[model samples]
Target: MTTQKKVSRQVTLELEAGNAAMVDIGKMLGPTGVNTRQLKLDYDEATAPQRGEIVPVVVTVFEDRSYALRYKTPPTAHLIRKAVGLEKGAGRPGSQTVAKLSREQLREIAERKLPDLNTDDVEAAMRQIAGTARSMGVLVAD
Candidate 1:
């Protein structure tokens, strides 16, 4: 029977989906003794569908120099910006209203982000997303 390899550490990286480069992966995981080339290939294939979004990956490095990757949903800010057709959020969010999002849009985003959110209740997740939108100066419409 094969024994399980002990986990050495975990590294978190936020990369443009389907666009992971071997150089970048090597830069981050080289010191940890993981095979960056294999990681990049797997990541690129797995995230191919989300080409334009940012996907967060958690790499669990094992003692034998092997690793496992866990993919997370895109950031809430990215989703919000995409929905509003903005390249970026307001520089002065507190004083400037950059855009507005309807409640329905808020719910849709909440649903998308539910798996990563702290609460299981969709209503609570919507509130959290609304708060994030407000921080970016995106008003939530009734």
Candidate 2:
């Protein structure tokens, strides 16, 4: 019997500084539409917390020798609100604000959107779907 396995692996690029060296790296990634300026901006944001820690960048390298970098900020407030069904802001957020989804909101969305779920209960389904959304980095609100 032949065993099938997952084919791809995740890779990361760890840089010591915010964007001090991205110019050199940009020359390498330019052809692939990996904007050097954007990369630097993302690098700065990721490193904003530590201000001194090494920023680890996870990138997806396709077989074509071109790669896509995964460096970005969290979803904006408007995004989270839309995901949760609020038209505007909820409670105050910290410097890096994170929007929230109440249990009610979670249940409502899951009940409406998910077609594959066999269960009929909205609350249970919502909780399950919320977990899925969180893992996928989807901002329904945004």
Candidate 3:
């Protein structure tokens, strides 16, 4: 006999700090019964440094149609970007920055918003923020 399957849906799963400790990975999977173990591991690794934040994960379907998952940090450095309320692909803090950006920039960042950034390092935060800008089409002068 032969077996094959395809992914049916993509979800922006919400995960918290202690998501791993929970045993029922299946319940969060919904009625589809998609396996959450691998997905949970991916998410945990990607967002381990900032465990509390809700990281963006890409869930793909395998040929058997079960499901495969991968995690990415907002697909475009959004965690820190959305924190300062700046534009996507926008500017940095030191090289002439502003507390409030233009409306379009705000909208752009908002559209590509990351779940929540619970970090303390400003530099690391900025790097993450700048990535959002680049993804949003903002070109850094440097």
Candidate 3: how large is its RMSD?
Answer: 10.9
List, residue by residue over 1-142, the lDDT tens digit for candidate 2: 9954332434556555454367555655555554567666666776676453344566664544444556532223332455655455424333323445656566565655444466777766666666654543433242
lDDT of 1: 0.92
Q: Tell me, by lDDT, which candidate is best.
A: 1
Ranking by lDDT: 1, 2, 3
Superior by TM-score: candidate 1 or candidate 3: 1
TM-score of each: 0.94, 0.32, 0.39
Segments of candidate 1 deviating more than 4 angstroms: none
- Prediction 3 TM-score vs. true: 0.39
In candidate 1, what are the lDDT values of residues 28-89, reduced to their tens digit?
Answer: 89999887888998999999999999999999999998999999989999999999898988
Whole-model lDDT values for every prediction = 0.92, 0.52, 0.51
If both were scored by lDDT, which would come out higher, candidate 1 or candidate 2? 1
Question: Which candidate, 2 or 3, has the higher TM-score?
Answer: 3
Best candidate, TM-score-wise? Answer: 1
Ranking by TM-score: 1, 3, 2
For model 2, the run of ten residues with the poorest summed lDDT: 71-80
Query: What shift in Å separates residue 67 of candidate 3 from its native position after superposition?
Result: 2.2
